[model samples]
Target: MIHKAGRASRAAFRQADDEAFGAQQNGSMSKSMPTAVEAITGQNWQSIFVPKVNCCEVAHADRAAVLVDGANYFSHLEATLRRARHSIFIVGWDFDGRIRLRADQPADISPPLGALLRGLVEDRPELHVYILVWSVSVIHGPSATAPALLGSPWQDHPRIHMKLDTRHPLYAAHHQKIVCIDGRVAFSGGIDLTVRRWDRNSHRADDGERVDLDGTIYPPVHDIQMIVDAEAAAVLCRMAAERWSDATGEKPSSTAGKNDDIWPRQLPVQFRDVSVAIARTSPAYGGRAEISEIGTLTLDMIAAARTSIYIEAQYMTAPAVGDALAARLREPDGPEIMVVMTHTSKGLIERFAMASNRDRLIRRLAKADGHDRLRVVYPVVPSPQGQTQVLVHAKLIIIDDTLLRVGSANLNNRSIALDTECDLAIEARNEADRAAIAEIRNRLLAEHLDCAEADMAETIATEGGLIAAVDRLNVKMRGLRPFSAMRSPGPTRPIFGTSIFDPVRPFRLSLPFVSRGRSGAWRAPEKEL
Candidate 1:
C-alpha cells in the first residue's frame, strides 16, 4: 500500500477538515440501477462516466461458514471437496496438481495434492468435480511446471473437466480465484497454490523448515484469503462457470453451475445482518459485456460505508476508482478510509505493465489526499536481521466492519475493465464478523509497522482505523522505511506505501492487468491440472 498524500499536491488532491467533494456519475447502466441512485442522489443519474448499476440494491444474508486459506492449491481444495457431500466445481487462472499440499505430510505414500484429489474422485463417484483455469501462463515460477512432453496424470482424470479460459485478450491473463463445493460453500480471494505462497502465521523470513515432497525450502511470502459459504460463495461459482463457458465454448453447467437461483441452498441465511454482493472485473464478456458491475460495487461500498474502508491488494494503481474514493473522503460525513497493499515496484518484467497509462490512473485518485479522512499503508514481513522487501500478495479489504472482500482481483484497469478476477466481501452488520474483520485489518497494519497487533488494535479503536492508529502510535515502522523509501522521497512521487488507495477518485479497484511481451506464454500443453 503506497501513500498518495505526498503526490496529493501534484494532482490537486487534498483533504482539509470538514471539506467534502462529490462528482456525479455519468455513465450507462442496466435498466434498474439509475432509478435507485436517483433516490440517493436526488437527481437524474448520468449513464456515461459513472454507470447506473453502481447504485443497485444489495442483499443482506443471515450467516455464512468460514473458508480457511492454506495456499489454496489442490491439497487444501481436496480437503474442501472431501467435506462436501453435495457438489464440487472449480474455477482458476490455472490449476496444476504436480505439487503437494500439506507441508508436514509424509512424502513416501503419495504426492499430497494429486493423491488427495484422486481419493475424492473415487470415494464419491457421484460428485461433480469441474475445474476451470486460465489457458495462458502469465507469471510462471522459476522451476517451471514439470515438462509435459510425455503426458501427465491429469490427462487421465475422469471426474475433472479442467479447461483454459481463452476469452482473455492476446496480452491479458484470466485471473480469478474461485472454489465451489456442493453449492453450499465457496471461497475466493488472492491466495493461490502456486509455488512460494506457503507460510504459517509466523511469516518466516526463510523457509528454513518448510519443504514440499521434494524437501526444499522456498522463500517466505505473505498473502490473504476470503472464506465464505452459501449465497456469497455460490454467486462467485456461478459467475466463474459463466466465464468458463464463454472462454471454452462449453454450455452453462447442466446442474450445479448456473445462476444462484439454481442453488438448492436458500440465500439470506443467517450471517449477522449485512448486504453482501459478488463483484467481478472480467474481460469483455463474450464481446464487450459491460464491466460496470465491479465499478458499481466499489462505489456503492464506499458510499454505504459510514466509518471506514480498508483495502489490501498487490496492486493499487487504478485511477477512476481512486477518484471516486477521493470524492467520498471530501464529504463532510464520509467515513475514514484506509488502504493497505503489497509494495508494488516495477521490476523489469513488471515495468512494461507499469507504464505511463498506469501513472495517469494513479494520479487521478492520488490527487485527493493529505486529508484526515484518508490514510494508506502497506504490510511487510521484515527479514530476520534487516529489511528485505517481502511482497504483500493479499487482496483484502474491510470497510467499517460492514464489508469484507477477499479474492484474486487487484485494483487496476485490467481487473475492472479487461481481465477476469473474482473477489467477495461480507456486507453484514453482525458484530462478530465486523469485529473479526476489523481486528485482522489492524493486525496487518501492525505487521507493516513492525508493532504488536494488540497495540495497533488499540490505536485503531482509538483513532477508528489502521492508518489513524499507526499515526496515533507515533511509532515509525521498524523494518519498513517511511513511505518515501519505497519509491521517490519527493511529494510528487509514490511514497513507501504504493498501490493501496487513492482517496480522491469516484471508485475503488483491483490490481491493474498484468503486462506481457512477445516472448510468448509458457503454458503446459492443454492437459494436466
Candidate 2:
C-alpha cells in the first residue's frame, strides 16, 4: 500500500509543483494576517487550520488537573490504576512492564508494574487491561527491549491484552503516551510508561531517585501530564479503541463505566466543567487517513495570543510555527514570546538533526524581533558541587491567559507530520477560567525560577509581563540563561535531523522534499501525511 501511494504521490506533486511555481515569481509567500478579534476568538481555528479529515471530537471533562513532574504523574497514575474497576487502556511509543511505577517511594509492597497488572486481573474477574505499543525497529534495540525476550510477563494473565502496533509507515512511530481508566479518568502527556523518567519538582542536581531498572541514576528530567474525567475520558476511550481495531483487526469488548469514577483521591482538581480539545497526529498508511491537528492548533495558538506566549519543549525547529511567531514579532503590538528549552541536544545525531535547525530558528527570530519581544532561554539548577542543566522534556504552551496545552507532541517536524502524537488543550471561557490558567503558567515559572508562586505572581503584576518578571528575578545564579547563537554552515543549512532523519512528510515519494526552498525548511505534504 505504501509503495503504491508513494509513487502516486510523487507523480502528482511533481506535476502540481511545476505548474504552481511556473506561474509565480517568488515561491515563498506568507499567509494573510488574521484580525486580532478573529484570532483570539478562535473562530477560524477549526475552519482554516485543522484538516477536515480529522475526527477529533470536542468534549468536556467534568474535572481536570495538571501534573508538573514525573513524581507527581507516576504516583497519581499508580493510585488510579489501583482504583480501576472495569477497564484500563494504555497506549504509548514505549512501555516496559519491568519498570517500577513509584521508584522514589519504598519498593512498592504491591509488585513491579507487570506483576501488579497480573495481580489486579487475578483478583478482579471482570477487570481487563489493554496495552498497545509500537513495534519499534531493530536499530532501536539499545533504547527498547523486546518484552517477549524477557519472558512476556504481561501475557501471564488472560485478562491483560498486549499488542505491538506496526501499522504506521516506515520511520514513523506511535509517539503518544496515554492511559484511560474506567472510561472516567484519562492521562495524556510526554512521559512514557518506561524507565529513566522519574524526578521530583525540586530538580536537584544529585537526586538519588532518578534511576533505571539496573538502579543506575540518570540526569534530572522534567515533564508534564494532564488528568481528565467524564466526557473527555470517554472520548479518549473511543480514540484508543479505534487504534486497537486498526492494529489487531479485533476490537476488545470493554467499555468505561460511568458509575466507576477513577479520579485519584490526592490530586487537586483545578477546573470543573471545562471544554477540552484533544488534538492528534498520525501518518497516512493502509486505508486510514492522516491527521495533523497538533501542528494546526500550534499555529492557531501562536496567531491568537494577545499578551504572551510561553513554550517549554525539547525541540523548537518547526518552520510553520517559527513563521507564525516571526510574523507576530514583526507586529509592533504583538505579544512577548518566551521559549524555555534544554541547554543542548542530547546525542550527536540529535545535535545535528534538532539543534542545528534550532540555532537557525533562534537567529531568524532574533532578526525579526524589532521590538525586542522574543526571548529564548534554558533553565539550570544550582548545586553545592556545580550547576546542572535540567532536561526540559515537557511539551507545553500557554498563550496569554486564555489557552493552555500539554501533551506528548513536541514543537518539531517529526511530531507535526511523521510521528503519531496526542495533545490536550483548554480555552478559557470566562474570567475565572482565565485566572486559573494564569495561575498554572505562574506556577510553572515559579518552579523554574525557584521562588514562591505568590512572589512570581507579584513580580509579573508589577513588571507588566512574563518576560519582564523573569528578567527582574533572573539575578540569581540558578535561573534561565539566554540562548546564544552558534554558527551553522548557513542560515538555511539542511541537517539530517531537519532533513532525512525526521522528514516533514510521512510518504516516501522522494529522498528529501523541501517545504520552502528559500527558507530551507520542510513542511508536511499537502497530499500526504
Best by lDDT: 2
How well does candidate 2 score on lDDT at residue 64?
88
Candidate 1 residue lDDT tens string, 1-529: 1011112221221121001111112221111111111113434432211222431124334444333335423344545555665456667665555556556455554355445666667786565556665655434422234422233565456665656555655445566767777665566667654555556555556656455436676544566655455455556556666766676777643434333432223222224544455656644433454443554455445545667777766676544455556666666766777665455555653543433323433343344444566555554555667645556677776667656666677765445545666565564444776666666666666666767888877777687565566676645424333333223322323222222222222122233334443666543322111
Q: What lDDT tens digits, residue by residue, belong to model 2 across residues 107-195?
A: 65635788878878788788889988887822352234657344475577778888888888777888888998888889998888876
TM-score of each: 0.70, 0.86
Candidate 1: RMSD to truth: 11.0
In model 2, where do residues sit more than 4 Å from their true spots? 1-37, 40-55, 137-144, 148-151, 486-497, 509-529
Global lDDT scores for all candidate models? 0.51, 0.75
What TM-score number comes out for model 1? 0.70
Where's the lowest-lDDT run of ten residues in candidate 1?
Answer: 28-37
Query: How many clashes in each candidate?
Result: 59, 1
Cα deviation of 362, candidate 2, in Å: 0.7
What is candidate 1's CA lDDT for residue 189? 68
